[model samples]
Target: MTPFLTAYLQRIGWTQTPDVSLETLRGLHLHHNGAIPFENIDVILPHEIDLSDEGIFQKLVVARRGGYCFEQNGLFERVLKEVGFTVRSLLGRVIIADPPDMPPRTHRILLIQLAGEPWIADVGFGGQSLTAPIRLQEGIEQATPHGLYRLQRNGDDWILQFRHHERWQSMYQFEMGQQYQADFVMGNFHTAHWPTSHFRHHLLMSRHLPDGVKQTLTNFHFTQWQHGQVQESQTFADVAALYEALQTRFGLGVSDARHGFSLQQLEAVMAGFAQHDEKA
Candidate 1:
């Protein structure tokens, strides 16, 4: 096996044949969602998100770390291609607010064709990420481990919705327009460094637990979700508690030593943000 393919499968905990069938696609998607978390610590720490395949592999696989949409979907796109699947990258606008607003195309997703049928595969959206690939059937509620998700046709665009609080809530929208690599590069730059970007201001981490529970840690607060609603929640008392939650809840390691931010430094930096929060 090629080094990249081997490491990619190992990272996602996939031990099956690398085929382009629907079963293989579902397995890859589900395994990836369960294994790699969605996090933005690099952006919070002011570290630039490298979009290169080698950079992503080294950081996420070799260093045992996680990343945001661009990094996660970027790496996933390459893996799908290496496994003989025809994959194309697409962009989407997050519209979670009350009044639906079309933000910049900041999210990355994949469109894969198998046996002349198209499916949407995404394992990157932190809180509302789909745990399995959904066919391109509009208005169909597809059951997944987390919850039911559907795609609604909105004029020329398609709105992705997740079942939350027993209601269908809009997550994002995308068109079939061909997206280029430059679009993702620009989006990543804005998301990583823009002053008002949430990734720049907060520490967010998420992992879909094997027990059908979704665990999320944002700043000092940790929340668990099951069947589309919050089941339990807590706020860490201190940086130490937050560190423990990081290791236990999200399965993040102590630190990315290659980035020069040791665990102590991480605690100090997070403390700085907490103090700033109080002052604000």
Candidate 2:
């Protein structure tokens, strides 16, 4: 096994190299979600999102900080490759925000073919990330630890939907065209630099917890939910409170000193969310 793979396994709390199988894939997906969080703090911290393998390793495993799609799945893709999984990178358009038009394909998704059966596995997608590998088929509600999800055909494309509020809501859509590292580079740049990209404005972070519980931070609001019901919710009144949640709940810290993320910058940006929450 490669050094990167060994370190990655340790980071995700795995003791030994897992065999290349569906069960291993599912375990890694769930453990990755629990150990490393989904966060867009780099974009909010005003640092460029680095998509290189070494850069991803340093930020995620070495620094022990969470990241958005590119960093999160980029690191996972390498680990899977090292463990002998036939993984393919794919791009998807995120429609969870219900944007007026079909937005750019900014989301980095993964497609794995194990024993001729296709499975979609993702440890990214903040808050609503897939907790296990879902079948890449149409019209069937695949039950995961978190909830039920289904994929539907949209012309020649496919859209992933999940059960919520007694309704299936669209999360993302994509065709089967395979993606490459360059595609993620472009997507990461757009996600970080695009002025209107939500990553620049919102402090989005999430992690899957024990027994169907999910923890998320959207701007200044923090929520803990279990099986689609809110168990606890709080809106931070100050950056100190928000910082506490990020550290204690999500396990992120100021580990990447070169990234220059600090409490002061956090306060400067999250001030907007604090004001917005007060008005709402």
Candidate 3:
């Protein structure tokens, strides 16, 4: 057992040995959402990424930092295993807000078996997801703090949905399957290095709140949402202000000259967005 897991468990207030039952799994999911964060600074920095248990343990547990889906779900899987839950890695795609029919398989998530039923447990997705595990059955609405989410069947894949203004919207579709670390390494590299990948062009960070809300920082904008309503939203004027917000609001200790996206570059990027939007 690594000290990372020990420390994480302690931080989550789970001093007792973890149980693999549904109740325990729910508790773990809630704890994860409330404590850990979802971030992509490592991706932006083009940091050496690894999917091994030890690698995830070091990044999330030892460093007391957060990561994107791959890193977050990777570590969460290991923690579940340590706690006696049956977990497996599953590949997923990002369904952008536009193009209602297109889904790109560039993301990773987790499928866990707890209490004899398959549950989708993802601590990696920053926003619009369940903080607790949900059953994989089709058309079954699982009530979560984020919203009432459901798994809808689509051919061989399962589509995750959230109730939005009394209707369901497809979030992402995933298959219950096994994947190895090597499978993710290629995609991770592409996303981190490829010019077209959004992660390469944007600065993103998110942290789950104690009241089931989520705080997100994207480019120069900071937004906090609770139960799907925007609680707070603001924009920074410069990179220095952005960095200050990251450290003060997100609890991140990032140096202005760190390995990831720099303050100047981020400001320029945000300026470009504003320009583009104004043009439109």
**Estimated TM-score per prediction?**
0.93, 0.95, 0.86
- lDDT against true structure, model 3: 0.73
For residues 16-69, write the lDDT of model 2, one tens digit per residue: 559888889988888899889998888876777778888889888988888988
Residue 113 shift from truth in candidate 3, angstroms: 1.5
Please give the CA lDDT of all the candidate structures: 0.84, 0.86, 0.73
Residue range 94-190, candidate 3, lDDT tens digits: 7636555664566787888766778888887776646888888988889875668888887998888888888888777777666777878766777
Candidate 1 or 2, higher TM-score?
A: 2
Q: Give the TM-score of candidate 2.
A: 0.95
Clashes per model (N, Cα, C within 3 A): 0, 0, 0
List runs of model 2 lying over 4 Å from the truth.
none
Candidate 1 residue 280 Cα shift, in angstroms, is 10
User: Which lDDT value does model 3 have at 98?
Assistant: 52
lDDT winner between candidates 2 and 3 = 2
Candidate 2 backbone collisions, by pair: none
lDDT of 1: 0.84
Q: List candidate 3 segments past 4 Å from native.
A: 11-16, 98-104, 255-280
- Weakest ten-residue segment in model 2 by summed lDDT: 253-262
